[model samples]
Target: MSGWTAHLPVLPVVLPLIAGAAIVLIDDGKRPLRALLAVLATLAQLGVALWLAGIAGGLLHSPWGSEIGVYAAGNWAAPFGIVLVVDRLSALLLVLTAALGLMTLLYSLARWDRAGVNFLPLFQFLLMGLNGAFLTGDLFNLFVFFEVLLAASYGLLLHGSGAARVRAGLHYIAVNLVASLLFLLGAALIYGVTGTLNLADIARKLPALTGADRSLFDIGAVLLGIVFLVKAAAWPLNFWLTPAYSSAAAPVAGVFALMTKVGVYALLRMGTLFEPGGRPPLFGGDWLFYGGLATIATGAAGMLAAQQLGRLAGHAVIVSSGTLLAAIGLLGNQYTPSMLLYLCSSVLATGAFFMLIEMVERNRSYGADLLAVSFEAFGLADPDDPTGPDDVVGIAIPAAMAFLGLSFVMCALLITGLPPLSGFVAKFGLIAAALEGAAGLTPVGSWVLIAALLLSGLAGLIALTRNGIRVFWSNARSTPRLQVAEAGPVAALLLLCVALAALAGPAMDYLQGTAATLHAPERYINAVLQAEGVGR
Candidate 1:
């Protein structure tokens, strides 16, 4: 590859880092300028991500004679210096993060950015952390990037001043602090035992260790798994997710949908890296299997019991996380391609739903006012006339409510895995693969997953149906005036989901290739360990 092409792996992380630093130096009075800068930076990041994905897909093949792009910082080689590796998986996630960042920032430009100091900077920093985490090839830097994003999230969670936001933010902060400590302890133990923090190096070294040393590594690995589980919001460890996410500002909550996925991403990377052929046989697979089932159950129960739309969305995030975790735990390569599709569908649907919640609530209040006025006017109409003012009430729904309702229904269908959408395609593919025992999944485990998938969809259907009725069918007085800034992003997100459905054939083909590559990690290991320098 050309020198410049080889450097694509690091740009996703570096661009946002520079922009965040620049935003921090700007005065708060120039809020408009800050927003503009954030938009430009995120757009550029998106471009880079798309380009890297092209490289991974062989659509932008280089002279380097390799599929993966590996970058070593400061001309340092692997096992001795920092490395950033971009394959199909990391490239895919980078694209997702950048797309979400751009859309969320656009929505925030309406008014959410003014809710707190340094909002623009924090947003950029969060993107930087997320990109860094996805691209980093070592456990130590993963912990560092994890902290970077979590710190920014703490500020964003409490962006608006309110008792609920503050209370939830505090709890969120406490839980993450403990998780970070566990991450550190676990990292230190692994580094001490293996004498390396690089993932490829660790995998290379695993089979050589004996007796007590191997046991020590296992303990550290389990501890690290717990840290990831907590972040993934698996069952008992997930109590804080719904409250914190539900109470945060809409834009913040929209972007936060990807945060839990970060945990899932980490687990996937590490779990596959340590599979039987490379290191110890996959540790914690059973826990992930059972924990995921419990997480699905918890999310379904929470969704059914939730009184507010935001909390319901929060539960939906938990359900998505559990679904992926369980699929991974089953150790079925056949399931990964389908799971990837479901992951994309869930993230987009949940993010759009979070944004839609505020608009729906606003319209409901406005509709209430309009209804009162209509009732007063009807009371003065002639009682004997069959087609008097009452006739107008039947068809008087506002355009904004119509838009919001349509968007809400689409979101509901996407989340619940119903027909004619990407959601159904994904869930069906997964179920088919599981039932066929394509990857050695036991009958009991397959049945459990089937039950979770079907029951969770039912729970979501009931919850969203009730909320839709209350928000639209109940009572409203006036039509809510929706702005392009508010409604446009929601439309764009839903349209993307539609597009995914339309392009299901190509998307599945790509994901299937990605799954195949992931299951065979030797190429990844070679790419990292054999790199000479940036342009070699």
Candidate 2:
């Protein structure tokens, strides 16, 4: 833990930061080099992240019985300087972010990256911000990283230029800008009362507050919680998600799948940090539970009502968010292991779905989607229609339609939590864990979640089946032009999910250890505070 790999914890952030800046200075015309640099940086991040995950896991089970790696930025210690801590949860997310980013970048090389200047740079910067967000141990730095993330995302969202993308990008920016203000206000308020922004220090300081200080802190925490919910795309604040994600180019939308989880990660981390002070979670109790239920209901309803493939995938993101939030909100029964497994499963499936939708959408005509939508409101020669591109050279040999059909089926099964896939395994784990709980949560609470999850899955099944039939079977159309770059990433993402299923037992074991550590956070606090500063 003390050798060269001590730097592993920080490499995820530094690699991307350096690569993004370097790429910016290069000529935009140097596409190959710029792309190569970006891909190398992301692959490096994936390597570092996996190594750190191994270290964290091994350390957790070693005689040392700890899984924390704290890298004091600028060699400065906690409470006084920036810190990056890699534990089970952060390391897990770090790996997830890098893997997903690599896939998105690969998909973009098919041409989305060429649609605009600085695409690779913005992509790298986005990765930097996401990695930094997962690694940072302080709220102020989290805000900085969040801003960096949003700035880059704004560019990525509007990368291809259409009225739909522009409109969605505007709304997306507006929402996050407001969320950012709330974030700063909340962080400032917490710092004012706690005299510290470092997570470990805040956890240590939260106890022993009197009346007004506690009241103000509580208000700030709620403000912060609202911001997180927005990022998580919870309920009323989530309207922007469907539009923004559905409107963005394929690769951009694929990467955006991980963005919502940032909010969930913050909530889980902070809940652990703050709970030991004998305080209820900022968003706990029946209200949180019911709010999550409403979110699930809304998401399922959207899925059922979706006309376009992009919107369906977007709604699927909402469903995943709702499930995780509801599990977290189940006051006494926290299904941590199951939730973590579900997190990995859902993110992979949704990201792949986003990318796949673009290719599937490409093969058919606009009227096809419009008529599909006409089930509520709303053409092979229609392919010659100017709006519906006819010039796309279809992939020869083993026909692109065959690939699309297989991929679409895989996505549908995964998103719907059907059997023999990681999604089914994850959903089963959730229900089983809830049932096996100590009965701390009320019966009503447990049953509500179980029902929502099952019903939501049902809704997903119906919607996806309808869409699949409409898109693949109902019409005769030219198959999409596929590239190895585009197809490879989607296939890889799905295979990871398949791997999760095949290795469910081991995956759950790891998650169980992670959950146990999360429930017991004293080690996390002590490790960060005791970490040495430079010249110490």
Candidate 3:
């Protein structure tokens, strides 16, 4: 690669940071100006990500081998200074972040209060953090990126501070703070053991540590896993998600689609470095799989309990969380690429769907109580309910509700691992890989995965259908009032969903390549070191 391309890793993350800072200084009354700036930054990030993704495909597939892209600041060497590495996985995740960021920005264009100070800057900072997380090749840098993103999310999540939102935000902050501390402790322990913070260097060095220190390393790995698991909202630790996500403004939550997946990405990246022997019996083995299955079961049950669109969407996210972690937990080299691809596709679908639900709710002035009534009646409630929370659906029977309930059913099925959609393709690939690896006990384990997946899918579908019936198809006489401009973002998002389904074949191929590259990270390590002339 040329020196010009060597700098590619930093541009995707930096563009957003600069743009976001610029937005902060701009006049708040300038709505058109803010939108223009946001759109430009988003587009630039998207362009960089696409270029990097293309470059990664060529590099990884090259017979000569691949190396991580390392950009030295002011010509500084890696260990003595900061470095960013872009490989197939990082590049792909950057692209996914850009896609989701752009979609959410579009959704927020008209949805956010133009005069609000926190809206634009906070989101820009959030993207900066996300881009940083994906590109940085250093462990400490990854933590910095995590904090940057989490801090921005802290502000974004509590933007309105409505009573319910405040309640939710408290829980969100508490869990994340604990997670952040764990991340720091893990990093500190790893740094203490290895004496270096560069991930590539650590990967090369980790294999050399055996004995009590190895056990210490194992503890650090488990701690790091705990931090990410919390972030990913896995089972037993995901209790805070429902109220927090459901109460946030729709567009805000839409942006958050990228947030949860960061944990999954971290786990995948770290897993590659530590558990490359495939599934080590310790931290990488059956524990993660069982925990993931438990998460799936809990999320499915929650989906059944949720009565509103926003809440249902929140629960759906948890279900996706289970699928992602479980896919990773049931790993093989072949499945890794598919899992990465599936996450990218799932984030798009879930984010788009989330934006749509928010728009529909705002247009209809629907509330939680109205949602409950509609669910019970199996019909759409009136949009003009002046009584606020007490509004009831007029008279649609269960049959009418069943018709509009199709969307929820599709969503449930999509997240729970049914076919035709990308979710099924992803889950199928993961399960097949697991079965292939299950020599002694894997058959029973694989069967358990399949059963949990099916049961969760059914439960989510039932819950989603129940809510959709009450909201969209109910005999409720709510006045209709959605302007085209209001729905434009969601319409654009839905188009992305179709695009994913249509482009599934090529996407899966890319994922396969990415997985192969991740499994044998020689290219990733060599790229960064070779850039530094350490091995050359």
* Per-residue accuracy of model 1 over 392-415 as CA lDDT, tens digit each: 222323488789889999999999
Please give the lDDT score at residue 216 for candidate 1. 85
TM, every model: 0.92, 0.92, 0.87
By TM-score, the better pick of 1 and 3 is: 1
Off by over 4 Å in 1: 277-284, 363-398
The lDDT-based order of candidates, best leading, equals 1, 2, 3
Candidate 1 vs candidate 3: which has greater lDDT? 1
Per model, how many backbone clashes are there? 11, 1, 12
Candidates ranked, most accurate by TM-score first:
2, 1, 3
- Residue-wise lDDT of candidate 2 within 245-340, one digit each (tens)? 998878999999999999989888888778787443445556556777888999999999999888999999999998888877764434888889
lDDT of 3 by residue, 1-536 (tens): 34455566788778888988898888876868988898899989999888888877784332123534567655567765678877778888888888878877876664343323458778888998999998888889899999999899888887645567777888899899998899888888888887888877777777788888777767776788898888898888899887877777666788787788888888888777665423223234577778888888888888888777777788888888887787777656656766775686668667766766764454354544123432334333344555523323223223332322344455545665566766677767666766676432367887887777778877876776676667676555443344344455555554565566678788777778877777776666666555652222
In Å, residue 229's CA in model 3 sits off its true spot by 0.6
| Candidate 2 residue runs with Cα over 4 Å from true position | 59-66, 331-334, 365-397, 437-440, 534-536
TM-score of 3: 0.87
Report the Cα lDDT for residue 213, model 2.
Answer: 93
- RMSD (Cα, Å) for all candidates, in order, is 7.2, 4.9, 6.3
